[model samples]
Target: MQTAGSIQAQMVGRSGVVATLALCFIIALLEGVDNQSMGVAAPFVARHFGFSPAQMGLAFSIGSLGLLPGAMLGGRLADRLGRKPVLIYSVVVFGIFSIMTAHIWDANSLIFSRFMTGLGLGAAMPNLIALVSEIVPDRLRRTAVSFMYCGIPLGGAIASAIGALSVEGGQWRHVFYVGGFAPLILVPLLIFLLPESRNFLASTVQKEGRIRPAAISTVLFGERRTVLTIALWVTFFFTLSILFFLMNWLPSLLVRQGIKPAQVGVIQVLFNVGGAVGAMGFGWLMDRTRAWMVVLCTYVGIVVALVVLSQSGALGMIYLGAALAGLFLIGAQSILYGLSAVYYPIVMRGTGSGSAVAVGRFGSFFGPFAAGELLAMGFAPPLLIGAAVPLIVIALISTLVVVKRPVVKN
Candidate 1:
């Protein structure tokens, strides 16, 4: 096994990279469960509190509100305070609030708790990406980063299964109860299991003395790196918009098409399952290529799948189309993350990725809400197809930018 010093000699430090990433992945795994709790628990929580669908939607939107600030702030914190500390603090804080959410008795309390929990939730993601980017060597960075994201869908998958089987098993508060304790269980493991981001350590320290963790920078985004940032964020934006529309809208569409509720649940499971498959496979493929062709194609596939799903008559075909869309649509966007670590240097990695992801979160914020509003308006399939038109345009834009110039700076 290569030591950290050896990694410095080569592009990657092999020894700790595997272990550190595993630790990050595990932490992210539980954190993933935490992330999906709101959506998974929304219906039950709304029933318990007598919340209207609109109110539940607003409750969900509040978290995004926190996420907006958190994304921007987390990027800066990861860059400034160091990835490990920022992640540790954020994870612990989120966990506490998550547990507290289970106890909330009213809409005001729940919304306030969710918003606070989201602060921690929103804050944690950027640093997690930053940490992954910092530890892996330059060549393997993309592959490693992609692997790290597998935690997201894995977490979501676990949530899906729990959500599906336990779909209506208990009070929705139980879901939050589950989310709260999961990360707390990881706190000690993270403290001991996960070390500081290696590059974060390297960039800040020297033979002279100890250095502050946040004061480091990589050469990825020097003064020359300008145009690339814009392109990356553009891809990040539309890709998420595509994925969010499906995750949020597809179920209602299926219900509208006269599918049974149980089958709709099954489709949701497949959607998440396909996402897991895409992310898991993406790592191996990315290890082989630079352009991340899988991601580009997936965007196109998502568009096509959306069109197909819109018109699907057979239940089997509907399921297949949904799975395909999930596979490419959600998975393709995450591939960008994998690509981010590959393209950026360690110093600016967190900022670059977080900024792109932060902007993308805006797409996430509006995409689902807009789709739901449209669905409520009786716009029909054609209008929804029109909504999807932007994705095609975004795909072309991403293709030009990602192929020609992949990396960006904060």
Candidate 2:
């Protein structure tokens, strides 16, 4: 028979895992809110700042640009220092900058604030992924990560709700105020309640005993990891490009297509709500089914949704299309994140995941900027959205390669 002490320990461990997952979920939700805040608030921000399409695109892309360096640096620091402290610091950075966003007086100030917010946002994700991955068993990893990530879309739905409420009143700054303050409020709870990754702690002890972790280049590119890295990066880049494009520009496109602001908010809310459901559902499927089947279904869903979004005219149809788009697009993105977590071992997981995310940030940066330029050049909304189909196909191909390869543990 099992000893009572051992069972108690197991129970404590399970509770710890639950707590960590819950905290990570909350943070992910906050990130979703901040990320979508600008998108939902864009119309009002542009009007208040007198920003043209191209300039507004620049604003959207700049925050993503900050994500690049932030991911690289944050991932590196998490490995070197620790996940808990780095994550806390990142939350503080983003929270402060998010608050600053509401107070910006001009374009330069706005850019600066958002870039800093992006830095914090980028930094937090790798740690979140790393921490959750380390805590969960292999069988439960995907579902757990997806469960945490579902917070993002739900949080985004909250932002959309805020936008819907504030849009008529020109209370765009209120969105930022909420995004900025909530994370800060959550900080103390994180400090007291959150635990560092046991895997990271173990690795740190090994490093102290003269068994240093592998060099960064070796961790990412050595031991037959090159192909896997490239495939993962490709998947991240294209997937994120389309996802961010839809996120940042979809509302504006609907408005241009003669949709009312109130209705646009409804579509956005449905989009994120569908995303939250899809993230969890597909993640469950990925855990239970063949990855290729999930990949095929996800990409096909994305294509069909895009087509519907572009071609449909009725509000209900558009709403359905938007929801489907969010369902597959965000679902696929969450799957990629889970894959990255499992692909690398605890020693280099942060850097591996971070690098992939940083590269994806490049695509995220380009998507909105490119779309803005295209729209400025008189591209139709349908044409612009249709263009994402090829990128989705490309992402599907690369993601298949990634899932087929054996995961690297050392």
Candidate 3:
């Protein structure tokens, strides 16, 4: 019998695997573009709709609300039905809704369109992570996964570029139109080119009559992994909270910090550029060293970067700080996703990653809203940015706990 591992071995170094990675990267890029589109478009959207900052914050957070359910439901469906179908369906869902966003007439309608778009975006993520994990060789796992995730920051950079263009002459709705229509166009390519996860078919469905309850249960409450799972969730939550806070509010916050309006996009692009570098570097380090150690050190870098950002005195310093922050913060999150890929068994990998992402989405929701509230309360930007320090410390502790736990392979 060809076990999942053996099947993976056969696929190592194949051109098809490279193609798979490329397509997955593009999918992630689209998700990133859509994800950051709102942040880039926020000021414009608010201006058009006469929205308060708080209302804009709500617009930012509400999409994450849809992500929560979409992730949970999508994970379960991917585990049962198959990763390919669920992934394709998610792309279609997000693409169509993103297009619909271009047509919204009011704030409520905008929020509704975004929330629906979130559902598709959320559904696609775990499956992408899980699929890459299943397909790549063990030696290349971290690197491949990290490379795939680089699309996220790259996508964000693309959004910032679009934002810059919008500032020049384009409308914000054009951003939505591009975000929506591109994914719809990609659907056909995905259907024809994307391969189903062989490990999932071989190890999950064929070997077992059906997905066992233990498969799902073991990821959360299994004896060897329970503590690790909890710690992973904590790490994901804090990191994502920080990430979303910056993603949704960084442009506006920089505007408040007296940054030149034109320079805002440059800073955003630099942030994501650093993120891509960090993702690849951390992935290389994790493959070469202890993952937990790499993760711990990365969080430390994040704390230092945040502190620097809070007290930056010059444009150069602020740009450097933003780059460092994106490097470690976003890189650390990518590490968590890679960890989840390696941590769980094939049977429930999608569920495991989805659940973690779902939890992180709550942090995503909280980060922006809390920042808005704090701003409303007249908190300083420095204080607001520095607040993440303690959360990263807590994440560091959780990672320490995870490191001490035994690896459980199902």
Predicted model with the maximum TM-score: 2
Model 1 ranges with Cα > 4 A deviation: 1-15, 205-222, 249-261, 290-292, 381-386, 406-410
What alpha-carbon RMSD in Å does predicted model 2 have with respect to the real structure? Answer: 3.3
TM per candidate comes to: 0.85, 0.95, 0.93
Clashing pairs in 2: none
The best candidate by lDDT is: 2
lDDT of each: 0.68, 0.88, 0.83
Model 1 lDDT-worst window of ten: 211-220
| TM-score of candidate 1 on Cα atoms, chains taken together | 0.85
**Tens-place lDDT digits, model 3, residues 146-213:** 98998989888898888887853548887787789989999999898787776676666443545542
Give the residue spans of candidate 3 off by over 4 A. 1-13, 168-170, 206-215, 406-410
Minimum summed lDDT over a 10-residue window in model 3 is located at 205-214
The alpha-carbon deviation from the true structure for residue 8 of candidate 3, after best TM-score superposition, in angstroms, is 12
Candidate 2 per-residue lDDT over residues 1-410, each given as its tens digit: 64432343344376678778999999999999998998999998999989899988988998888888888888888887778899999999999999999998988998899899999999999999888887887887888889988999998999999999986698898889889999999999999888777656655534333435568898799888998999999999999999999999999999998999999999999999999998999988988989899989999999999999989989999999999999999999899988888888787888999999999888889898899999999999999999899999999999999889765442
| Better by TM-score, candidate 3 or 1 | 3
Residue 178 C-alpha lDDT in model 2: 88
Q: What RMSD does each model have against the real structure? A: 4.2, 3.3, 2.5
Ranking by lDDT: 2, 3, 1
